[model samples]
Target: MATTVRRTVLTLPAATVGPPNPLPALRPLDETHSLDERARQGLPRDMARQIGYEPLRTLLPVRVLDGYGRERTPTRLDAIVIENERLRATVLPGLGGRIHSLHHKPAGRELLYRNPVFQPADFALNGAWFSGGIEWNIGATGHTTLSCAPLHAALVPAPDGGEMVRLWEWERLRDLPFQVDLWLPADSDFLHVGVRIRNPHERPAPVYWWSNIAVEEHESTRVIAPADEAWHFGYERSLRRVPVPDFQGADRTYPLRSEYPADYFYDVPAEARKWIASLDEGGRGLVQTSTDILRGRKLFLWGSGRGGRRWQDWLTEPGTTGYAEIQAGLARTQLEHIRLDGGEEFSWLESYGALAADAATVHGDDWSAARAEVGSRLSEALPRAAVDAAYEAWRPYADAEPAETLATGSGWGALEVLREGHKLPGTPFDESTLGEEQAPWRELLRTGVFPEPRRVTPPGPSLVAPHWRDMLETAPADPLAEYHLGVAQWHAGDLAQAVRSWERGLELAPSRWPLLRCLAVADQQGGNAERAAERYAEAFDDLCEERRDDGDSWTAATVALGREAIAALLAVRRTAEARDVWSRLRPSVLERGRFRLIDAQLLLAEGRAAEARAVFDAGFEVADLREGAEILGEVWSALTDEPLPDAYDYRMRPQS
Candidate 1:
């Protein structure tokens, strides 16, 4: 670890640039009332809202404080475009080192940050100006840890007397670092936009970074952002593994929507979907620019694998998911970035989600009525010429061919990457260290049944089965060695043999998660829902205990099996009866956590579409879970009365 001191926590020098009007910066619609006064007065919020304002209030159960946490005042810039109060632009510059943090008060669903890298424990409330979900290197925790939120951001003032829309800067922390906010110009209907990086340090600094952004919501949060169209990946939707890239051409626009169980990358189109637009001072504008830093810098986006619920595919079914979370930041298990010196700054590109809903969710045919309602209201708001130019500027980059990458191989075979050494989040193994227990480990892969050596480890239980003759004897004995051999046999389509293995393993070690997982799978495969659920319950309990020591495993970021177990019970129509069990293990899903998944689920169940959207919108108010898909799935399923399955196979399989 670097012995770097907190040279400057966060210094905002608004005096040099312009006067700063700090947030909730007292305004007409949104005001900068102190947290306590807002609480006393019960401030009504409508920032990310469009539909039901009342439902939206309950959607975000945040705790607003009297004042923001201890921090410097914002540098208030003069309103350059004070043509009118409604059509004015206020700019605040010289925030060279002002560290913005989330306050505990005003606890909205979106205020999911507690502190910056400087303070890693004080989780913040979601929503507010700067949500502190910054990106970290993949190997920081061996590809399991994800940089999902933001630490700080800089909303740059537009040169034109337009709305200061573009932001460029990031949280400056010596540890857990990212140093840039890469967003597009908000006042694009006016002029060209750009930002300057002020590297004050003497030496060049290597900083790994990316932007944690939340676009305006609409009919759906699903987006169409492009990294490079020609990018390919190793995507396994069910196991929660991200797609590893295989770029081939220059540019490829990928249309990423959470319609089905997708783990692959597709191309983004040059055409932009008319998004749900805000009729502002000028008018409706299609000026969203979504881009990433991967093309030029070493950055990537990782799907959040934590946040409880086993990182379950709760919202993965067809036509249910939403959002196009573009991750050109870092791979799940690699360096996100390496700043050459202490003063270098790298920024990713931008993307705009479509606010132009073509048809009503109920009608799905035409936008004639809605279009006519506000046809030419704010033409001045859109800078068509600038938007066109941005599209053109991004064209050379967006439409370029993907970067060509050759697949590497080892003598053991190209498929060797799927070996036991291939480390993952919960594998409980070292990636660089290859231990003696690899044979049986591979055997588990070969067979679907548990290895004879009970646990995946080598020096485990050795439960001999009826088909023990197939096993070769080794000098050293393993307790669960018999289990691995059985699993390998089962995966090869020998269920009878797999059953024999499980029975034998049970004789030695009656309760085990892996075995029960296999048993539940086997039962499901055999069409025994009752038995599968029963065994899965046991597996869920065992796995929970096993992962007790692994904080990340059960972090508020990933879902736990016990949670799934409770949900599964409810899904079986146990309903009220199941609520009791659910309430007991409900801290992860119920008690305070990061994003409000349970709240989203509940809203969906109540058949409140607008409320559901508000839930998702507020949940993303702090950090974008890259979960537009899940949010859509929950609502879509709840509306259609389809209890979405917990797994991807269920999402992809043919419907009855």
Candidate 2:
């Protein structure tokens, strides 16, 4: 494919490690070389090279490609891990900004950032199995998927004294082959780590990826990206009460703002190449440029909260934490119509830059050239090698395990459909059923990653069926069973019942996601708008914080949630009271194209269809989601007596 821009189509095709080193690059994997079904499900390798059984097979094994379009060694690696499926991996090569910390301050532990093998994968990763034999498996889709989160697994050759390959990530044991991808192209600008799974037969196939990172707050730590300025503003997904909406900008589907404790999971724009930059160098500042295809011009800016953990007071403790992520394709696109085509592919790129040291920092005549070279090399090197090595070290998976075997013994359903990009803000859930949904943080909490629990709420669905409830009561001191039982209650519908169960579970674990969101949503349903709003927003934020378009956590959270407390109250004609809450919330509703529909409704309810029309901009301020968006068209037709919906993006993904 040719591009009008010089930078769009990259040409350099070798991996760059740290600095003066170039690793061999590989070519993309074709169907023949890719793993088959027998391989993906833990089926024994055709040529067993071990003394024991080699579980996990690969039907759709990860395929790697180098800048020169050559296939790397080992072909593919099945076991992998990732955060945002959308970012299935734009994992560049090398390990330059590599950070490997021996976390022994609070306790003795090790953390891996971009660490390469100078430290050798041959050590007791700090007395913990956190980092060991590590490898990367890049695939075609640059992000992870719902059914198949990017696979990051332990590479223990024969489980004996063989080399250990362990990548730090959140994952559940599954016998399915999820493709892994890495981007270490010859002329690459950044690194991407992603995963992809195309199985049209699986309806409601989801993107199960997210954004997460272990964190420690400091002045240099700040994040800036293109998002709704009011995102975490007054009424964001998170229950974290900003107690105010300080957002000031044009409203949009996904406004631009940053510096907050957010784990967001929103969708990629239809024209998904919008720009988002993160600072702190790595965590210092961020700049997002949403390109206007028409004008072809970009506006950029920076964000800094001056060491404030999050733009909004997420109020989460300063320990280990994850970042924001997305995991979904452009579902609402025309691609959904394609059959088992798994044709809906999502692609994007991420570039990391270091603060060029303000004028006060730079000196010397040769500085400019030096900096540029460093930037060029950095922007190139390590990432390339990292991705190259990842690709070169590939192996297809083979799973003989049945679907039943992969099913969670204590999960919500026999087979839960993959959840995708964020759903609309969900309804206030029943605290009783706070156990239905599975949280990505359960293991993180249990593994002592979070020893001191903070004060925050997670939102969304929580139900349980009678069978699970009975089992919970009979189960012995099985915290795992009890906790899941709480989840089942939430999924089954008894919100309060689930909450009680989870409450008990929390007493045992102290760190539960259901308690986080359920308590907050319950608070909302119970009538304390302030507290409810705070926690509800917090939960939403957290969910978003961990989602990627390839894995829209926020969207699902919203779909399950219904509407914001303030919006719901306003819907009930409690305008005056809602106005008060709205004042307290100070939501950047004006900046949210989605909420404009709400404004039109709120105005109409107050007998201001004329005002509503004005709010609808004579039916011009339209967005996506056809049928739903048409409600306004109907209302507007009645008011200005005009028809619309023809101007919205009513996109939809295909069902299994």
lDDT of each: 0.30, 0.29
TM-score of each: 0.30, 0.30
lDDT of 1 by residue, 57-81 (tens): 1101111111112122443321111
Best candidate according to TM-score: 1
lDDT of 2 at 482: 51
- How many backbone collisions does model 2 have? 195
Worst 10 residues of 2 by lDDT: 120-129
Tell me the lDDT of candidate 1. Answer: 0.30
State the displacement of the C-alpha of residue 334, model 1, in Å, after optimal TM-score superposition: 19
